[model samples]
Target: MKILVVDDEPLARERLARMVERLDGHELVAQAANAEAALQLIEERDPDVVLLDIRMPGTDGLVAAEQIAERPNPPAVIFCTAFDEHALDAFGTSAVGYLLKPVKTEQLTQVLDKARRTNKLQRAELTDSAPAAGNGQRTYLSAKTHRGVDLIPIDNIRCLIADQKYVTVYHTEGEHLLDETLKDLEQEFAQQLVRIHRNALVAIAHIQGLERNAMGQCRVRLEGIDTAPVVSRRHTQSIRSLIQQL
Candidate 1:
């Protein structure tokens, strides 16, 4: 499979490319330092797979995957990240597969083979159907809480409210405060998440609908739950867009 290696670190990309070269069936077609360059290379090279990094200077891997998958012919993606926890949910993005950092040769070969097989199966299934927006698959959240790392399923989350420095992820079990800033997580889970407010990120599937009261204050109702959350004025348009799409 022809592959494009993408990462900000020169050594990381080089090492990954060399690994790909070591594999018999795989070929390194290009290398990119950021998402923009990756996109440009995708348009130009049309490689079969992308070895992408999660974090970058601008337009992180997740955001770039969203845009690339929206394109006419997007190459399969395999996130080469340092975080092992992200591996479980990275497939929800446009990623066909994922590999942890300092990626072992054996693991790389295994994921590459899986990517090829999965790609074939996916194409066969979509052969008779129109191109869909996305599979509508929900991803789990790995957040570091007081006790330790907690796994919060996206379906259980009602909304994510951004505080001064942290984003409060509200779920049926209880609310958990995560350390990462809201904007970072927003980009990572853009498909399943919606920016309901500058300080809030609401799961699109959880949103039942918008209710406008006599006072002209509009609130968002959570699906399968009774509590209604306030929708900030700034995010009204995006909320409406999400509702219409759904």
Candidate 2:
């Protein structure tokens, strides 16, 4: 597990880093002296766990934890502080673990276990709640970025292409990974994207024209995309009829 240690005291940070390194499977990615630096490290490294100190010079750990929670994929927060009064407040922010310092090795181990379990549950929830395009009310794909969630409008999507187990959603900005399958995407955006291939779906608006190559196979060209998606036999007739109507 990747870990980021955040504490204002240099000795405390170094001590915590050493203790974390001694563990079997944990990797100490980086250490930060302040909450602001901690937030920056979190954004850059995306550590699985953050051992945060509650009291700092500026931007206290609680405030930083709240900001971390807002991230698309936030790391588990384990607030390690000398004060016991902030326990309730820490849990309220959905902190996975809390350690009262004068640190204990056994306590650290237990918190690490709890943090892993909590992180798993959070990821499961994200996967379950991930919005799909087909829902009438959900006309956007909530793509999780390095920073936060980006709500991509369906109109900006050019196509969806399946690569192995994952589906890549191509939009005006770029492509984002989708959790849904090609079938689900087609069902959701039935009014917009037409299935050109078994693994591909193209936007109806971008469907400029069709071309038949020397091999007598039909292909579709989009407005800005140069690569043509081949129309499968089953969808070819319907696509042709739809183009004629337009």
Candidate 3:
């Protein structure tokens, strides 16, 4: 069976690649470090099996698998994540196989065989985290950092900017790579945040100004943040009206 291994950790990705090559009858077609690259390679290579990692810096593995499940004749997905606590989240996406890292070589072989026999994949809604925490208010967000998971207060957030396969949450403390989608954040923070661009959402209280450039294109200047978030033409009038209240 052809295989595609996706993991953000360089060592982890290389280890899987080496093992998959040694396994009988299976070929390691491609290796990707993030969800965005994985999706691109999956389309370009069309491997029969995708060995995915659940947690990553940008888009995360489950989100990528959910997208793979959308493609016609999508490849079989086998999650290889360190977070055993996310077992339920993995299966929630209709995955036929799941493995906790560090994955054993013999175990991988077994799952690949199962992939060959697995003919259908069921689809389900994939969510990055629980809808709410702390009395159902979702007052904080859990983000993974190099050291560990950091809990960021919702009130501290200034804006969210979409970058490649991930959306970065910009807050008072610092910036973070959020696993949540831009649309999801907009909906989740609807009362406090508003869309500034298709790729960005800014906090209403943090909104500084909506100014037009020499080109007549509107740009949103955020409070205490040097970078300006471009306001889309489609949302220009709406942002202008909101600026009046500010």
Candidate 4:
């Protein structure tokens, strides 16, 4: 597989290059110091996979991934970082995998294989699933939660709370912390999910209204639900604006 190495540090790029060379069917085609360079190489080389760093000088890896993904043919991204807490949530991006710093050779091989398989699956799905081009809103998601992998429908989600690295997926019956991030799923499902806070995304259809208790802290009420989800005071205006739109 053709690969692109992206990292701000020279030593880190060298380490990844060596690892790719060690793999049987892998070759490093390009290397970049920042997101801009990475984007340029991706447009020119069209690599099969990108070994991307989460943190960079100009643009963070997550934001870079979003930009690349908007292109006509985007490469599969495998985020390399020191943080493991975000591994679960990043799965929403359909990334081949997330590798922590000082990545082991064995782990690299496993993730590479996984990436290859996932890339094939994504291509197949794109061809098989007919596009709804200008019709109704789309639903369904492939998420990794504590209960393992979940093929959750958007309608089933009552609310979503963005934790440090993962988003908590709440349903009518229960709630689960998904290994997926808010940015990964929020934009696509904007009509279905409403941004109550910078870190919190809730199902718009399920929201009943906004509430204020004796404590003066604003709370969000959901239809057919008793418990009220707290909406931070800072996000009060944002919530009200969204409610008016609804």
Candidate 5:
């Protein structure tokens, strides 16, 4: 995979560059000291992934990531920061990897491998269907799992259930926990998903049927999953209308 290293500190950039050289099947395409130069290089080089730093002279990495995401087929971003406090904010920008300063060779390799896999999957999806136009909404959700960062495709998600602070994403493969709030997810995927209850949002395309249980409580049946999420009375009529349309 082609790579770009972006950092304000010369020593830091050199360290990461050396690491990239040592890794097989990867090439260092360019280096930039700030977000401005990085963006320019991104257009010119079109690297597969970027190793970005948070603090810079101007246009911090976080903001730069948001801008990169707006571009069509943007390269994956892997943040290399010295602080852990920005971890949450980093993932919000659709970053696939987050590593602390003085990054280890093993960790960098792992993250890069994950990024390569994600890119391959995304390319396959594009070939299968017309790519969705960029609208600042994420096409995939990143989750930190035991293996590493898992990129869950938004279209494959069956539903999102909020228990408290974390939302559980039920997808085509299985379920995964996310740190995002349900409200934020609803806003982000409003067109593709619909709210069935206060704590749940089901994918609009996956809704198979709506039925009432023995006690007359409404529940929604979704394709590919046996567990039917309950439908609130307020949303029952809307769900019925949707079912009729289907």
Candidate 6:
């Protein structure tokens, strides 16, 4: 497996490099002293895994990991940090593993093995399955586009519409077909999304208002979206109450 070591400290970078040399079947592709440099190296080296540090001089590991997750076939992230406080946040960015500072060689080997075994989708699933704590939800939703992997930020999302088996994500930028079911997305983002209809889930923050057509059919107006999704009769009252609070 190809690997990149990203740390602000030179000694820490050297130590990790030496450890990678000791391990078999792995190559140290490059090293970066900051998150910005690491991102650049990722574009150039295209490593399979990155041993990242959480507390960097700029950008920080959490934000950097989100950016990395947006890439097509992004490398697995294994955070090597002195602080364990960012563990949940690390996993939220679809990180495959987390190792405390003064990382042991054995631990590094185990994590590398695990990363090598897991693919991008599997890593996201692992993060979804992790116990919810301290904003453990993913910052962006990944979808396979004709161009490549398209990452839609959760905050920019207006609504998710289900058409038969596929779910389409409507965000601020535009729409993209998601390789996910509406039911699964509803359950995963229950707190941030509201089930306006059996086939639709709208972001709670994007709910502009509820409207009734001339025929008394209810529809929901969402911020930044031209089309208003229909609201089921069963959920109309509930949506009204929700809007009252907002």
Clashing pairs in 2: 134-188
lDDT for position 135 in model 4:
58
What lDDT would candidate 4 get against the real structure? 0.74
What RMSD does each model have against the real structure? 12.6, 13.6, 15.2, 10.8, 6.3, 14.4
lDDT by residue for model 3 (136-166), tens = 5576665644322345678888888998899
TM-score of each: 0.50, 0.51, 0.49, 0.53, 0.62, 0.52
- Model 3 regions lying over 4 Å from their true place: 119-246
Two-way lDDT contest, 2 vs 5, winner:
5
Off by over 4 Å in 4: 85-92, 123-141, 145-246
- The digit string of per-residue lDDT tens for model 2 on 1-246 reads 899999999989899999999998899999999988888998899899899999889899999887777777778778889887877676555566678887888989887876665564443233434334444245567554432234567778888889898998887777788767999888867788888888999999888888998898899877766567778899898999988987
Give candidate 4's TM-score: 0.53
Candidate 5 to truth, TM: 0.62
Ten residues in sequence with the least summed lDDT for candidate 3: 119-128
Which pairs clash in model 1?
Answer: none
Provide the clashing-pair count of each candidate structure.
0, 1, 0, 3, 0, 0
lDDT of 4 at 40: 98
Which candidate achieves the best TM-score against the true structure?
A: 5
Better of 3 and 5 by lDDT: 5
- What shift in Å separates residue 146 of candidate 6 from its native position after superposition? 34
Which 10 consecutive residues of model 4 have the lowest summed lDDT?
A: 124-133
Model 2: residues with Cα > 4 Å off, grouped in runs = 123-246
Best by lDDT: 5
| Model 6 lDDT per residue over 9-70, tens place | 99999999899989999999999999999999999999988999999987999888888877
Model 5 off-target regions past 4 Å? 120-150, 153-167, 172-174, 177-246
